[model samples]
Target: MTNSTPLLEINDLSLSFTSYAQGLRQISTQVLKNLSLKLHAGEVFTIVGSSGSGKSLLAETILDILPKNAHVTGSIKLDGAPATCAALRKMRGRELLYVPQGVTNLDPLMKVGHQVCLRPEQKQYQEAAFKRLELSDAVTKLYPFELSGGMARRTLVSTALLGTPRIVIADEPTPGMTLDQARETLQLFRDMADKGAGVIVITHDLTLALEISDTIGVFYDGTIIEQAQKSQFTGLGEQLKQPFTRALWCALPQNEFSTPKHTGAAGHATSSASTASQPESKRAEANSQVIAGNEPENAHDAAATQASEHTGGAGDATSSASPASQPESAPAKDAAQHAAQHASVLEAKNVSFCYPGSKHCVLENINLEVHEGEIVGLFGGSGHGKSTLARVLAGQLPIKQGSITFDGQALNPHSCSPVQLIFQHPELALNPRWRMKRTLQEAWDVPQSLLDKAGIRDEWKERYPFELSGGELQRFCVVRALAPTTKILLCDEISTMLDAITQAHIWHLLLDHAKEHSMGMLVISHSEALLNRICTRVISIDALNNHANCIEDQ
Candidate 1:
């Protein structure tokens, strides 16, 4: 790669970390192992890998942000000039920029305008970049604390553009926005590259990456194992003509595949035969009833009487009470006019919360209820404690004050159960150390038989997270979360990181599961479109803040 020819090139890069105990031995975690990549001017490079596969580490290394405790050995060349650690660090704020995974990069205390232009090196270019980034003028006066999740993302994009850097590195930039917003953001990145800047996106989202990237790089085991033009990888039938290729291909979509169709019939047949031979196979299932004959009423009465006597007659009725004295099963003969309503399933009362040391409340005076089988949405601005509130509802976090009751049972913060939280980013939620089966195994309540029935064929339980794509990781997360003792499902912005099609599939799966079991849910989200699709009722935090607004909207 020549100077002024290629924007950046990394050769034989390796990085790792060391850990030592007080008096015992030490340990090392090998991260990136001999990874290499190149970014040309006016091109978009996408890196796709599962969680804990060193994708983030590789991006951090390129940005010169790797931890000091880590050992890094690599040659990073920028525009053909040797990029030393000191040189990269010295020019970081001016010649290079990064847009991080979520909304945390922006300063909450400062107005978005001030935060966007906070870069000392890029201060002079802030005004022009703000306009170029398509940020609203009102954004300048509003702090990050007040912006919606989508708006916060726009601020970060504006901030990165302000630097006018030669290369822009974005890590999971579209994780919390609607489909339209995600597409538009990707278009912006494409436009940036069209103007000669190098753009590198680090994500597990293959569908999103395929849409905008010029070049695609697949990461496996801390290395860039494959690279090709985006066009070459998009056509599944064309891209994968071999068995191994097809396995990787199917894995990308969160589906399981063993090999390619073009492989010898014997190869395919052997795999199919193995699958057929497995015990508990339902593909050949018959709808035959397996039951014990019903017992007679007299027999049941006799058993009940004996059990009542042995248990000290808790089930015994008083001799003086006649059958007519018992309260009617229905309050009235024709009860429709005065039917008693069931109690609310769950409620949040007068809840107010703020992060530790923060003066502003993210959520305030919040009162809400979830009925037995309805799906509710907690829609709000970024950092407004949407995740925090979901955490509280799922008992992951304790409410600072207020109460939550489930089915008339007071919810004890320390003893909450039967509620599950499916995180938005699977990469963060999944354990890298566990194999696929072991991870799913922790859910326990999902019948092993049912799992086997729904199991994706291409999935290899032996493979680690590093070998999977974003969609694959997300599917595993879904399987793990839903395969449990589920009563209430608390979804924390799960769809924000997925592509439109994938999001639709996940939403449908959730709906189907809920319908099948009559489950209740409280879904936390920022995308109105997604809420409109899956939620029965959408409760905007802004509306709750003003009673008049709620009344007017209603």
Candidate 2:
């Protein structure tokens, strides 16, 4: 447990996937770059990054679970001995455990009880673990589909601890759970670490995870850009060593977002004016009063009145930033004023939907409208139907109760779908077999400049989904959704998997394009700060559903 002998040590780990592109041409896509970390007993080591930053890949590599085509070059030592695949086999379940990000890990046809119990003798331990996680006896008899998302996550957590592993790697284990459920699930990991077990958790953000983590690793584009104590993420992120780490900390809903003055040599946010010309710079500095004064008398007219009355308090909170990061307050007001004159482009009137077998409806009698040149924020937590409503509006899901119209025409997924949708999980949205170039070409003949604007490299065009990182693949998806035919854009947590700098650039491109074409967008995200910064009006999905519970707490 001491520095002299750590429980797990990963040194200079680099991973690449060998694949055939186009014809029989061989290509290797390097994913991890010189990744190294040490996990000692009794510490909750948390890794936070944008999607596809190789956080999950690191966990998979440590567990020796990478696919056959994966070529890894690194030294992983378990208890100071070289950890090869054979060594991982000896340590996987007995000494080490893994909690996956998705709940589909459970076999659909298998009973929850059998899935948690690794062996016949482990049934008793599995039952005890379930009880500790607050799973009832009846849950054991049910299938995964019968369980809620929170319940399924708890089941996965219990499965990982069946053998009481000394080292645990939990990859993005808190998604789809309510705030309290996520906190409780992470607390269980913290408890495990407190009892002298080495625990690792990969997370999207540190808003809740920070409270339990002892140390934090900030990852950016396949590398650990910075490592710091949990307490170092304070004020304006001055204690943080890496610019990307500071940018991530600052971009949180709780922190003030200063425009990136420049990107550092490592691609981290610094004083980079490189992306300053992006439309996001203006949107990011837009009048906070646009959505901060609470829901207006009429959500559509809110931006108009607020822009008319917005004064000079926008820069006060972000005073700690450098002069270059600040934008003139006049441009934001002008942009909002111009947006106020646009006509309605999309509408969801008295719409409601529910999963086929669910007892309660996720959305009920929801009425909303998006005006031309407007960015409406659909703010809500998991289980509140933010995603479902997005799918329905985008015509991905059927409209059963009411209607969703774009440009006064019915939305049809099979057709041109003026309502283009960029999904929450880019991995599922993109085709695995298609190369990046082909994926982009499916919708529009996207230009290289457009791809570059989305932070994509030209070389990535030849690589398949498996060869690219999650964030990289997502960049392709974003560019595709911005097709010329798209009218009402449905951005379902589009930037969730991207780093702060890349996120800024993409938003800059989207907002800029939206302004030029007078396009309306429905932005669904859990980050209230982001919604506040970019949206003309932010409305709660739960409020739309007539649920009066805590929206942020889910």
Q: Highest lDDT, which number?
A: 2
Residues 283-318 of candidate 2 have per-residue lDDT tens digits of: 343423333435444445444444422222122222
Whole-model alpha-carbon lDDT for candidate 2: 0.70
User: How many clashing pairs per prediction, in order?
Assistant: 6, 9
Q: Quote the lDDT for 172 in model 1.
A: 77
Segments in model 1 whose C-alpha atoms lie over 4 Å from true places: 1-4, 21-23, 108-111, 119-148, 233-238, 241-344, 347-405, 408-486, 495-519, 524-554
lDDT of 1 by residue, 1-554 (tens): 22446889899999887755457567666778898888998889988643445777787888777666788887889987898878888768677878876565677687766777765766666666556544556568776655555556667776666745778898877666545566777877888889878999876456667788988777655887777665665444367433333344553323321223332211121122111111221111110100012233344333322211111111112333212223334434224212213423667888766556555566667787765455666665443456666766776665667777777777655643666788765666778899777887776645554443222334345557654545556666776667445767788777555433334435555655664555677777755434533444456555554321121111
- The TM-scores of all predictions, comma-separated, are 0.59, 0.79
Error of 2 at 402 (Å): 1.8
Deviation of model 2 at 57, angstroms = 2.3
Collision pairs in model 1: 3-79, 149-382, 175-496, 243-260, 256-458, 257-458
